[model samples]
Target chain A: MPLTINNYADGILHGVSFEVQRGENLIILGANGVGKTTLAKVLCGLLPSDAVNIGGMIPSQTYSEERAKRINYIPAKMEVFDSYLSVAEFLSLSHFNQTISIDEALSKLNILHLKTHSCQTLSSGESQLVLTASALLHSAVYTLFDEPTANLDPTRMKMLFELLKNDTTLPSKIIITHNLDLAYRLGFDVLYLKEGRVAFHGSSEAFFDQTHLDALYGSSVQKVNNHVVVAL
Target chain B: MKKLLLLTSLLLLAAAPFFGQIDLPLDKLLQSGTMEHQVFFELRLPRVLLAFLVGGILSLGGLVFQVVFRNPMSTPFTLGVASGATLFTAIAIIAGFSTFSPLFAFLGAMLTVIVLFAIAARFQNYDPTALLLVGIALSFFYSAALMVAFYLSTLQESYEIMRFTMGSLDVVGFNNIWLLGMVSGLLLGLVYHYRKAFQALLTSYEFAFLQGIHVKKLSYTLLFGVSVAVGVAVSMTGPIGFVGLIIPHILKTLYRVSADKLLWQSFFYGGIFLVLSDLIARNLGESDLPIGVVTSFVGAPFFIYLLLQRKS
Candidate 1:
């Protein structure tokens, strides 16, 4: 999709374009305000950048309502639903026959132990992870997670990547992440945006190399052992 | 489906005449169609039906505000729509617009809600808190008008106005049951048509939009439906409270709390609570107190208890 600048240039999501394939896992990498999140929002049928003219189809456009019809988005915005709903209660309430039960979803995420817990009682990491599983319980054709592995340790990160990349029944996945390892481990295609423009589009192997990442992220980028960091 | 059908059947079989002191010996009454039964049919039956009808309307109306505001605390009073209507009704009556009081009350509420929406829309972004604040402000403005009316009124007028605003199920000679019956059916259909929008509201506005709910459309329709339903109830029986605010919450707790099921069940529980509350209110004293007074006395502390329970 071709994105541009206009009246709401501040809101004009710059530097973004690409099409994702069926059954593929695409990663969006960018520093804060570079428009990775904005792109995701546009695909989710949120009105595209106020500047509009977000260009056309992604034969490469990884996100679209056609894709969205089957998409499950794990927006960082969700907390726990605590209005008299336990984890179990939430599962049943949201179950529309197409999805699995709460316990089943939890078990898939390996958090079945939390079946009876209220969201408020759960720790932040637990809440985040559980919400992710719950969001994906409906398992639309695609799943988009905005910084999904934020607080999860390395093990859970690996677990989520495995689920996203290897899901035989699921649609393609586009995960927006700051964590380079998760991005590296779970990639089929990668799109890196800088200042709202696509800086690089290629495979994980091409983008994961230290030199490319450093160049895209600039002086703010650092390498500590094998982990890539975009300094806040 | 069976549960709903069964409840309806039970409600019909049990009708109002049997359970109270004014028992109609059905066999004897039907045989001669006695004056006692005629009066019972004329009076108490209509009152009971009116109670059920108004209760359902208010409860359904309250659900609309709660869903739209996404705040459990909002109702006609908290949102100021009820107070605005009460003010209009009192002012209308003081000016001797007896028959037109209901229409005046309804227009007052509808106008207040529209103004509240207009003010909220002026803010750069949507925020529930902004709406709530605007609602409180609007409600206070109209209520102040009502208070001014109260202060300048004669003692007899004040007494009549007080009773009306306090709300009651002691309606005699007129019951808007026919109108309510038609409106309730229409409102129920409207609620179901927007079922998905209400469900999406359970998450957040952004998310609900993603689910294909046009925000402005759903909000306007829901608000309009709420105004019509609650306006009719207020015009018919004053502003009976609690039955609207509490019944839906209680039904949500009893059920799974999903927006879809919650909407449907609220209708049922609203009827039950209103019928039962009306029964208690009318029978508790020799002369019936207004149903609003009963609901407030009952609802205020129960609401406090719910808060305390939530805190714990």
Candidate 2:
């Protein structure tokens, strides 16, 4: 069964609908304050709606391993309340796959040295990497990442891009990002939200076409050598 | 540091009963039927145990409340449970049902818990802030009701209510001790069983929910368990303040570990802190000072110091 949001409407979002079949990845792209994050929360059941369904089960209704195995959502910034909870301890909570160890996920993100660091003490970029590491260990069927590279430096950004492009870590990734260049390079199916509505939902090639880019972003965005870039 | 703290805690627990107002000589205490033996066993020993168990319950309850509410200032008392107990105990004293004050106090606390949960259920989402505000409002209401009780009471009844509100640890036997011990055990067992989920909560509610924790259900279960335990403790001790609020904070600072890892530590240190406070109250002067006063006197400054240290 597919992951589906059948015309989910809320205060911020108008009528949002989408579906992702098993093993099919998706990219959610939107400008600021367009309800991208809100949609993500609704889809993952944090906002708790009957509109979101994962493999014939509503994410909000399911519990324990049955729900955990189906979907996960990684927020932009890692928020840890306890001052002394280490990164390793945080990652262990999401280690359900058993295929990849916490150490492996940390090393993959070049964050093995941060294993013993308290999660509260990590820098924003470092914390983002730690969150990404947790998603790796989680290995859920449908993992939605919100602004995964928002705080990353260029090197870490490239490292994460490689991981996401390879499609070997998580089975079906739903990445929400404002980085059009990254979205274009990933070449996944795109669902663009404009003012809480689906403005565009099609292949990345079509979404990134020069005329389509001009219509949406005007002259502020352009393409050079098959790479999407901002005019500035 | 942890080992040293543990050793010191054990030493305090062992020595608490001996340091009270009427000192019992060791040899005299050992004899079965002497006044010293009776005082040590029937009065001192049970009082210390009572203090410890109540402290443990309050401390654990505080830890759980802070985690669930995501606010460090939160404790079982903050939710008006203690105020409810205090109000009912005052009402009992005025109504000439002073003998059944504990029962009345417990019913008041449980009734507050039921009311809080009922209001929380009406929330569209799990809004802890709204619930906290409701708790504060309930506490204000209880405080006003307590004033009315005082207005209606005789002078002697008012004094009795005042003493109960200030809190005491004057149990004469092991009956209440056994009941408190069982309550403490049940609370500890429930918290221990949900330790993993509790750790997830230490991250955030959203993170815990994403981990398949049934965040709302788990939070409610833990809150209900803690409320019942705190109700029993307040009924027995008449709402000892600061032990619940300060013990968990102190343990967290000393251990430098996540709150979940400090569950047993919070409970143990909470017990020890109260026993120590009681020791000071007993030895300070001619008449024993109130247990609540001792806790606040010691807890307020120390808590402020910890906060200042954290800032720097």
Candidate 3:
């Protein structure tokens, strides 16, 4: 069944509703404080809500493998409370997907060398990469990523972009990002939020149109050579 | 280094019962009906076992509390469990029910646990920091009540309450040992059963929730288990300090592993630490030192050293 949120409302999010069908991907775009992360949390049941449903079951109300296999949410930052928890150990905890091995996930992210390093000691960029690797291993039906590329270098960003574009890496990805170029390049459907409301929810073609971009961004965004770019 | 530390700990545990103030001759220890035999089996052995069991429980409880609260400074007593026990013990002395102080202490601890959980249930969200603040406030309230009890007591009763607060491991039989053994075993079994869920928690609450763990239910279950075990411990031993706060940290530093992987290590070393402290407290003076004082005296400097070393 499709993942659907029917008029979900919480603090800073007012009557936000959407749907992501099976095998469909989405990109959530919004300015700072527009409640993109909060919405992602609600959709994934981190912030419990009766409005979110996946396969006829409320995401917030389900538990155990049923919930885990249906949905997963990766936060913007990796937070490990134990000082001695290693990167490999952290990844192992997310290894619910029997098809993907921990070693394979680490290698795909080019972080196999950091397997034994304590997660607390990793740089932000490294931590982000580790979190992404965890998502690949998690392999939930609907995986929501909040600002996945917020702390990556240009080269690593390219690698992650390719990984996200690949259908085999994950089943259905709902990415929350501020990087308009990355969002445009993926060519996925866009759901834009403004002031806790959905400003636009349509195909990338319609959302990235010059007139639409100008309307939403006040002429600061340009579609040059078929690529979306900001004036700044 | 880890191996050396473990070996030293095992040796200390073995040698602890032999080093008390009144020496029991080795030859007479095994001979039934001898004074040495009576002291060895009836006094020293029981006391050492009590120390070991209490130490293990407190340290393991500390680890669980620190993980659940996500605060390094948190201990088994962070929820005012010890303060509740202490206050009740003082009340027992004032009420002339000193012989049943353990029962009163247990009641106080369980009452605190119930109050804390009741308040926690009223929150709209599962917030550890709010629960922590409530615990701190309850501790302050209990302290005030204890002061009133002290004010109403006679000089001898005041001394008795003071002694209980300082902590003790003076047992004469194996009765309490069996009870504590079962409690410690239950705690160990519960923790081990939830090791994977606990490791998920070490990442973050939200992350653990995403992993299909009922974060609120799991945390409450673990906390309740620890509180019950610690209540029984404090009721019996009067709340020995430092072992809970320091053993988990020390084990983490030495083993360089996740807290989930160090459960057995924490329990073993915590037991050894108390045994060694009790040994020193027994043999170092004319009268045995308070177990709480000895733990603080040895634990504080070593803990500080570990902290400074970690910083560098």
Candidate 4:
């Protein structure tokens, strides 16, 4: 089953469309304010648009287990409202895939010590770890993570990179990020957004070539030893 | 500490109906023909039961409103449900339909809910703050309309309206108590049924949505159920304030748990809080004080203390 978006136009995105086949991961790269998050929301049914469909089902129209088992979206930031909702409690709520235990998910992310802590008390990086733990417990078919490495330290980022690269957690993952090195290393199909449109949709090798990098990032990026890096 | 508080509260609830201006001993209560028995059955029992049920409904309603609106201060009255009931009751008194004031009050409450939901359907996004603001605006409008009713009424009718605004628990017999019991039971049942949804909602709306919960529909259903039950309770007791706002906060403080875990706790403790307030209201003076006045006077200071303690 493939995820497809056709002729979708929210205020920010205009006629943007694409598809990601089952078991095929994709990376969404874009400049600031290019409607990356908006598109992610549309795909996950958070924004409620009829323009996107997942596995022959309209995501926004379907609900409950049917929709949950199809896709999961990990937001850029942890947005917990209750002050007393512990990490364990939160993970338990999303434990739809009963095969994985909350403790196992927490340990997988090296956040077992933070399990009993209130989510409101967690630091940004810690909360990101908790969110990753939640996504593992959620274990949907296709999980879209927005900027998963944005707040991570180098070590945690590498850990997350390994998770994405190995596909140990979920089957198909759509990672939205600005980390060019991480994206290049992951070797997924790339969907580049610019001015609210898909400026490029191709393989990592083609998207990361020097000519393409200069075209997209201008003089701000440089490819060194097969790794994309900031020009400075 | 928990067990001690529970024991004391239960003891107080049991002892409440026995004490009044005219005291009834156990012997007199057991006697079938005494005035003490009549007062016990007719006056005190009904009033206590009414206070308990109304208190439970209002506090549980407050918990639901806070979760639905994502506002700590939001209560059943925050959406102008009580103000609507008050205004309609004032109209009934001024228009010589005072006997049907309960029915009018109920109608007013349900009508406000219908208007709120109708406006909610037109909201572009599921933004609860916008709905809360609409409720506040409606309350102001209802208050202004109530002033007009006060201005147009006879002195006697105006006084009746004033007394209703003060809130009373002057129930006569078992009939009203049974109705209120049913409403409270229904509200409690609904909350229990949706307990998991409420827990999911206690997190962010986006988080709840990602968990396969229909956040909007569940919120609307919970809000409507609580509002209708609160409307019924308000029609009977004339919009008792502070019970809904304070009891949940107080219970959360005592239990050290999330709002979802405190649904039944809020109901039990809320019932006790109102019963205690009514006990104080009846025994504090020769004439019974307005239950609303007693609750606010007791609730406000305690709520502030809890806040201050939590901060420090």
- Give candidate 3's total backbone clashes: 0
Q: Model 2: runs farther than 4 Å from truth?
A: none
Cα TM-score per model: 0.80, 0.98, 0.98, 0.98
Winner on lDDT between 1 and 2 is 2
Across B1-312, the per-residue lDDT of candidate 2 in tens digits comes to 789889988999998899877878899999999999999999999999999999999999999999998898899888899999999999888888999999999999999999999999999888888989999999999999998998898889989999998999999989999999999999999999999999999999888888898888899899999999999999988888888788888888888889999998889999999999999999998999999999999999999999899889
Per-residue lDDT tens digits of candidate 1, residues A1-232? 2232233333645434455555667888877877766677666645444332324422122333333355456676554322544666544433432546666678777998988775557776776777676566546555667888787777887786677666654566778888776676665678777666677778877887778766666667666676656678
Alpha-carbon shift of residue A183 in model 4 (angstroms)? 0.7
Model 2 chain B poorest 10 in a row by lDDT:
B246-255
Question: lDDT of each prediction vs. the true structure?
Answer: 0.67, 0.91, 0.92, 0.90
Instruction: Give the range where candidate 2 chain A is weakest over 10 consecutive residues by summed lDDT.
Output: A60-69
lDDT (tens digit, per residue) of candidate 3 on B1-312: 888888888888887888777877888898999998999889988998999999999999999999999999999999999999999999988999999999999999999999999999999988999999999999999999988998999999999999999999999899999999999999999999999999998989988998999988899999999999999999999989999899999999888999999899888888888888898889899999999999999999999999999999
Worst 10 residues of 1 chain B by lDDT: B207-216
* Model 2, residue B45: C-alpha shift (Å): 0.5
Question: Model 4, B61-85: lDDT tens per residue?
Answer: 9989988888888899999999999
**Candidate 4 - chain A - TM:** 0.97
Candidate 1 stretches greater than 4 Å from native:
A1-8, A11-25, A31-39, A47-67, A70-72, A77-108, A111-143, A168-172, A187-206, A212-232, B1-34, B113-129, B173-175, B256-259, B306-312
Residue B101 displacement (Å), model 4: 1.4
Backbone clashes in model 2, listed as residue pairs: none
